[model samples]
Target: MKKNSESKAGTSRRDFIKAGTAAAAGFMVVPRHVLGGAGFVAPSDKLVIAGIGVGGKGESDLKSFHDSGKAEIAYLCDVDDRRAAGSVQRFPKAKYYKDFREMLDKEHKHIDAVSVSGPDHNHAIHALPAMQLGKHVYVQKPLTHDVYEARVLTEAAKKYKVVTQMGNQGASGDGVRIMREWFDAGLIGDVHTIYTWTDRPVWPQGIQWPAQKAEVPKELDWDLWLGTAPYKDYVDKLVPFNWRGWWDYGTGALGDMGCHIMEAPFSILGLQYVKDVQASVGTVYVDEFKRGYFPESCPPSSYAVLTFPKTDKTPGDVKIHWMDGGIQPERPEELGPNEVFGDGGNGILFVGTKGKMMAGCYAENPRLLPTSLTEQHKLPVKYERVPGGASGHYAQWVEACIAGHGKKEVSSPFSIAGPLTEALLMANLAIRGSDLRIDNRYPGRNLKLIWDNQNMKVVNFDEVNQFVKREYRQGWELPTV
Candidate 1:
């Protein structure tokens, strides 16, 4: 947290670490800083991190960063003190602020990086300023609430020259690396089809917004919590969770789980910016003889077909079939009926000319068709594995940022994460468009949206394009950079 300038003449913790690591062989004693206890500081290469939305997963994220042994939890920011209570107690020495703007304004210089585990809607707002200030950022998966925001964050990372990572730990997993090596080895020659499914929306979806409003809690700043989204009356059970099902807040199932499940094919095949997408969403009824279209709420279940332009690793166009809400593709003939497919609740499968392969959530437990080939196949490792695999994800970003951008490789940097998130958001566009009632008919359900990636618009469906970049409310504005 020293005032290390971003220039050759300046001595940063990055430089400090590089010097120590280089001379490590000759060192006989453990560094004093490394052995320092809680709230340790100075004379070390420990990265200083300020966390936004430091609650629940946010708390765990900071803990993981500290567990890296090279990071210090320097600050915590969250709108809901109730949710942030645990992290506040754990990192009591770290400064605490209710509004991120205040913390960033007063302490930006003291922090080396920022981690965002806020709602999807506020991701871009929380992450952009830190990057603009030249601090590294680690935001949660499905990087932003909208496709345009994802693209903006992607460009900003490069513009500001900061290390960036999206929290899809699977992207850093050995399973994904194994699958990539297998594909490179031609074990699943020329993948043409893919299926990624999840049994999610464990919270509420396909329901009407509550008519009754609840009084805002004493410890929560409802306005700050609703950053960028339109003003809505405070409702019970919406905060901390259940926000995922609403359009104004969360991106529903696809936004929640797509990045984790779909990342395998994307990484292996180099898929980017989906060209066309179509979807079918399950219906939710209000009562008997009353089939209602609840556009405000995400459909309980849905299936979407996304087509990606062929990459050098593929034979032809690639179509990824995405299913959620327990809907799954028919089992492959090679697998036994009793055997679980994709850990029972979630999975991803790649169908290729020579064979097929599949993996569970986070691309874990990758196996070739017939289950017998999973262990028998002999393939040379083409890529390096992340030390500690998925669990090492937070540490990877911590080290990469401490080493400065481009000094160390991170699996899900925004350059890679942006497009991955954008594709899934585009799928969300199709999902939301499904219930659109125009001319007394639902056209979105039958339409195949042709995406204009350059413009960030759905060229064919003008109505759905509004979602590409949602209108911000609550006196907040999106970042200009």
Candidate 2:
């Protein structure tokens, strides 16, 4: 069976002709059985999927969908051939292309859905058209590069009536459900304050762009990779992963892991568009006398505070603190001196009127403070468990697509992922606002920028609104929903 599957994996769409010829030679295959009628596909029929950005995390995403056994990898697209090599080898029969536009243009008929696992900047660029063409989309986390794009995609999902899921797999994990149960049971009363921190940037940041430019790799399409970001001379090591630290291509640490770290609280608390946001970021010194301020690059470390209006789950407004670049909140008194705080490196903490709770990245390993409370408390399960938990996220989206739009429930559909993404980007506005300088003076400092979620703009800070919706490059435009 493994050999048979391998052989099938290597067959391209062009092989259909050969398959037809073979079938005509008295070797017809069994027809799929439909329970209701002949028009309906049998349970065995798989959804044909096209993967955009089939490298790194994208490569793993394609594998997960294929492994679901309910989806067939029909096409793979990527700008970097070297990065996409593994996926191309694994899905031998899948057609390959460098530009996602070309792939979607030619293979739209053959693709049932599109899985987008690209850099933060190009997610919306790749996803918008696919959705317009009525293809279901599963975009990797941070859904879009900016707040406006997130809102557009969210509305587009509903307008197109396509099954949509953001690649924040933790949204479907048991850890969040367990935490939800605890919160609903009033173990941790109304959550008034929340803190999520990460030791990210693990990449270069708080530095100037390299003065020297390097030759583009032979196998990589540098122009195509830039997609919606402004074009610049090729820099060393920016192709595969280092792009995360740059403002043009990435969303810094908060956007990198915010979805994973803050997902549980957003869901359990029913949080939405933030009411207001403010921030302060650490600075790097280029020399003994001069401080480094690279607007193109994210700051080395920063702290942001977002205020969310009250929801039924909370008594009043919720103040959420986000720290990155190795910053963390203070440890709770309930925890032992040596006890781990949110898995020791990155985690989320919730402080309520009654007690405190914390969880590591992806809301995993959730526990109430005092350690003993986790094991001692018993709460009735009120949420449905996602099949296969976090790992099930891919299969869930695949099945949802197979079931058609609105037919099945998806764990991190655009509706939910969009607001979460928008809120994060809103927090980012504060970070970027605080960084703005006017003749060596930071004017955006110490101001609580009011937000008009409906208009998607910062009422108090007009300059920061530029980051709300970035202008796309000449060739790419965010599709009008």
Candidate 3:
């Protein structure tokens, strides 16, 4: 393998860096801070962005980029035309393609950055190539389908020297910053416990894959949609939305909301990879007569407790409890009977030695327990707040990419996002371990899934290690980087 810095061959990483350095001239002419409006940018300063998976959250991500005014949607790619229609109409001038390879091969020179909003299983494959080509990348939450992929992405960002961000907008929210301030000021003493809950899996989970396969939609490329996952027959209501429940495509509820909820604790407490995990999933019944355990799909509800190694901010190991599928911890007595818990269906709470603090999903509306303390303890903010908070996340990346890697800070760069994602995926290992059945028993349920971060595997329950890295389908593979 050639050294990353040596530019011996054509388009070496070094060459790419030089090209990017030269491109930085477009942004240096006038700084974004001096630019007056949110959607106003000189033509010379625009960052050409290519979007992969242009539908639903993907569509909205592209819209936010364009709204920043610094990003011009130069190219669009998605496996399904039906999903890409809205974005295609919105950015009529952008060249369109059904495959990301074609778009990157033909338009790499034009695209300064890439925004990836494909399914969880497809994130790594979609983002890696763009980064290898030296394009800044913004990937959707959870970062990848598995822990190994997350680690690969984390290292790739450093090796390739690309500006990278995860699509967890809440990471840029003021509430998280304020939480960090309170924690730093010792308002909340050594955080020992945390609780994050969400009501998700609204589609389907804890069940078996549909036995009846449906005809593949005409506008969708079924093969491409499978991307890195193993091939499976198409099923009704699986395209676009309900894929979250299936392990083949999505990371289940944790993938859907873990980034939004667990992020607060991870950032504020300086949490790293999980040390071990224990989990119990809600049971399903078949015809109300027998208990059912479906290994192929995520459970309808799960409660996982992950232990993280001690950090600079913690007195000892941090215990984080994650509840999903409407299951939540007992309400804290400090909260009034009328006061809402976790924005009704979702929330994050920190239990510290001095007091307790809580916030809703996205870490929005954070407050100290006893309610009175929130108003009583106002600490000076040390960390600068992200402009526009969550809404500013898009512009933050756009500006950072223009400023070049190492020049600016992103809210959820892969460095942070990778560990955060691994923590959640580790929890997933426990969840998946609990469901594995032998002849007639589920032995994995009794195991405490110990994590070996160095090797990226579970030391106690070896079977669960399968989830850490998954095999991609033929003709598609993870980027060498």
Candidate 4:
């Protein structure tokens, strides 16, 4: 009774190949009998899932998986019972818990996958254990809270031989795929620079910081929500969406939207890692002690410049400029007056030697410059539909899971996404006043000002390396790579 043969009865040829691959990789390939004479079990075949931090983003992620119809929601876990109540109601059949570890321990055998949509700090804790147990994972973007954790999760996904997908849904969009094709086809010649901007005006930028003595919300589990992050008082301004502007719970403007706006360039250009990053932060509008809860001292605004060294596969060099909190880079005059710019919170502008292309957030509805560029330089008709929608993204991950393909099979697997995330995370570091230079040639070089990723520490700058790996609260240490 070979596992592959037993599972191949009614499975698609592709799925059969996938299952065999998973077995080869040493993942547990359980073959159960199908009740119906249908000959094959559905991919969902007894798949049970757990949801961690089921609140705003977590709720949305749960719905996506539920709609897939490929898995049963078995557990809803959130530190805040109030936040998890709605999700519990939605999936009344599922058990509920506050600590993910407890859920994993009690229901370990019953769970097949986990959706980690917690705050940036807790993303790793929820996803890592599941991957260790060979459970598939679908974590939201800016995948990990820190650069080191991003690399850790990527490695663990491989070590555990489990299916993994990051929740940057735009990576699966048709428009985004077109951007990749256009770049690969040389429409965007020798990509030297890219610009992404966001106008996240939330949380009342430039206002006086709230006092630290404010009473914590009764319905919110502040301690549990703070999981791996350092302890801080409960403040109304830090709850819900305001967390995005704060350093403790979120990654400010860049991390908040980098995965969305930066996905196009990251996917299209095959960006490796940051070479160097510097920033010009704004003046603080509020008192430092009053706003100590957040990362930045300024009025929630900054501009940062990032450089990427050329790889043998990539051309000359590439520079990415990020503008956040209503800042926009000075558009080059070469783009022309008629060219459209992104109006919403996010946009990506690509300037190539041959022509230019611009797209809205998530690379939606991209248009070539000069309008005529579209007609003159059209992508192959066959490649037109390659990138589709978010549903396709989820579907791709599920298919890979059922087939046993590792995370690398997906477009934005952690291997590719990890470095892109590192680059973006560096931007956050730069904005935080770290004087660090990235050396892609060899990571983690100890040069006083240079970062060496290979060594996993900053050259001559222990402070910078310390920044790379944050201090987790007791019992929340991230696994070292």
Candidate 5:
């Protein structure tokens, strides 16, 4: 594990400095007095940011933060130079490094925050160390790879008192707020059932890992790319995006889209931690009568149901059904037979006693079913709309980080994002459990896995616990409190 002052297990910050690494390296820790008093804003202050996994979504995140003007891109890090090309070109002035640990170790004194947009497996590894350094962190969705990491990061955020944000931009969108207003106005009375669906895993899934090993590409550091995942030979097409299908690197379709599509309902209903979960997964048959078994990959498709006990905002237990891999719920009767059902490809539907309402990805274009009701009904807007809506998510985090912890409110801080992520990962536990085979029989099939949220485990099933907190590869371990 990387030693840091923030880690309870490592040498304290004061001790590390006194030991002479700071002196020998000439590392200068910025004094709090220079950053100003708590909650006191210096008009000239700008947050210095470091980007970990600077490619694709990571590239976009960096641009958005730079666009905010309140944040400066001081460093960029990624294992694959090919993926990092665009960002390196775009931010030529920012120092670049291939390993985040090296960058953080050498530049922690200079960075005020870190943006983690790496693959799902390494999110916690990158974000936790930064938080330990007292630097604010902006981690992308599916907050962590396992249930345990989500809980660890959540608790660490509070322990370190750092401003943290999850990159679920929809949390900053107006549609969720509008839906919240509608729900509060009783337009959709007591939503007991909700459905979120997506057409993802467009890449390969329900398939076997490539049997043929290929030479590692020159631009990519295959070992570093693997990060916390167990070592494996490099394979074609897995580097850029196909990693999403493998359980070793990604969280499948649900992890890819759940944070966005589920945010609105989660926010409007004040939902968190699940009580139990059950799932039915779609399988690919290799032959006329035999089903193909690819334990290493995410299934081609899956439909999971999660039960969340009543919260302050909910009238009773809420049942959330998640469908992915082009699987969607039945269209509401009020929707025109020819009319689109939630932007045609993906959507969220809420069934309440009074009516039904639905929205597309990111909770965009939310509408009360029967279309006419959306136009005719207007409720008082009780929630303050986010400035610039979804687009402002980056700027909001930048401003909040600059303002320091607790100085401003953020839409998807880890406190909320952690529970939301854990709930989704819990659903995955059921999906994975459904695939367990015992004596040619599906031992875990169709069973409701009771969950002990406080304990973070399946109360009735031990088989699914393997996924609750995955074991990191020999070299990488999640930090302890």
Candidate 6:
């Protein structure tokens, strides 16, 4: 097992100093204080931000950015006006709009940044335009509705020269950073397999089918809510919150939670691409009496296996297994007595050659193995603490905007997130049908899938690739990458 801070593992303080100096030389500007809050400005001096989706997560985003004091609310846009009422009330000074484009066109100069907290499909639509306008963007997790869109947004951010951050805020946390430090220190030797699962029973699992059409609420915009997605009659069950389980709107359990649980291993291990992936889905269960928007029936619970080849940077193979619908992997005995596994719906379990490590969703406080080793582990004596929690994520992005800082070399840029999203999105594809095999490595193989990041298509499977990128209804197309 590797040593923790208590044990003084790997690099010494002097070595870290040399490394830090080298890193500093690569970047032209240096802050007045290396570890102090000198480079950032007060929230009052921060830029003006608009919210594209001001319901659900969007509401939370408003509070986070507002609390940062680094941004002023300039606009609130949501298709469902009723859902946005609270936000509209909170920011009376900020204009409210049912459509985002109207707000963007009229208040273009007044907005300095945008928070995209819409459904997975709508994220790219709102974010791309904002970035194209040189507005900094803070988009929610899973980045895009489809794999191709993720790539487009990443490229656009590069061309526009804007500061960008995905909603997977856990990626910026101290716990996540500590996880990286431990891995680099070789605490877990040659990690080859990982298990991630979520017991998301709240929303029904699988795309069994849609329930019967019901009266659309008087206050909701049914047509607008269905933006970009296929035209479907309004159903009471599908609206408000349960849209995630449906194929047309949400990405089911994996897409919904993958970014959160998959982040630790992806960041700490530098997992770049998936070599192959296959999934076995449960039977589709249907509810005869369609209440709200969703049909009562749903697909059976699912289990998927993702195989990742060794990359140039990480030369060891890794396997990621996902479990959902009240299922979990067999706990390893090595965790020892008095060890409590995470009780939450999502958790990550890492098994290295020497020891094991596990962290909860959102990269909260993690627990390491060999309880006795805890005392022996010596972490890097010197470290920098970035802000934490949801508020901190927004704070960092706002700070970057004011400082004119761009993407970090090792950070989770849109380029990285795009592909990461693609891999996760494939799991959703596999669960949709059976006997589908994906070989992302090359096109020569018969099962080859070639991705045109710009067009968002798989050349061979035009029909299937069409699903990779979505089509926008009139007036809703996200800007081209």
Query: For residues 254-283, what per-residue lDDT tens digits would candidate 3 score against the true structure?
Result: 989999999999999899989899999998
Better of 2 and 5 by lDDT: 5
lDDT of 5 by residue, 347-431 (tens): 9999999999999999999999898899898877789988889999999999888777888899999999999999989988998
Q: How many residue pairs clash in each candidate?
A: 0, 0, 0, 14, 0, 27
Computed on alpha carbons, the lDDT of every model, listed in order, comes to 0.86, 0.84, 0.85, 0.68, 0.86, 0.67
Q: Note the residue pairs that clash in candidate 5.
A: none
TM-score of each prediction: 0.91, 0.91, 0.91, 0.82, 0.93, 0.80
Q: Write the per-residue lDDT of candidate 6 for residues 1-481, one digit (tens) a residue.
A: 0000111111222222233223212111112122134353333466688998898888988888888887788789888888898899889998888766556656654567889887776777678766755577888888887766776776776776777888777776776777677777888877889898887646865444645778888877777677667787887677677877766677777877888778878877777656556566555323565422222223346777777777553657888898877678887676665565654567888888878877778677676775456557769833355656434777777777766644333245676676678778766555543423245232222343433444544455444554666666654555444
- Cα displacement (Å) at residue 100, model 6: 0.5
Instruction: Please give the RMSD of candidate 6 to the true structure.
Output: 12.5
Worst 10 residues of 6 by lDDT: 1-10
Top lDDT model: 5
Error of 5 at 12 (Å): 8.1
Tens digits of per-residue lDDT for model 2, 106-140: 66645678999989999987887677666789999
Off by over 4 Å in 4: 1-46, 204-209, 212-214, 286-299, 334-339, 381-388, 434-449, 460-462
lDDT of 1 at 448: 94
Instruction: Give the C-alpha miss distance for residue 257 in model 1, angstroms.
Output: 0.4
Which 10 residues in a row give candidate 4 its minimum summed lDDT?
Answer: 1-10
Model 1 clashing residue pairs (backbone): none
The numbered model that scores best in TM-score is 5
Q: Candidate 3: give the clashing pairs.
A: none
Name model 1 segments beyond 4 Å from true: 1-44
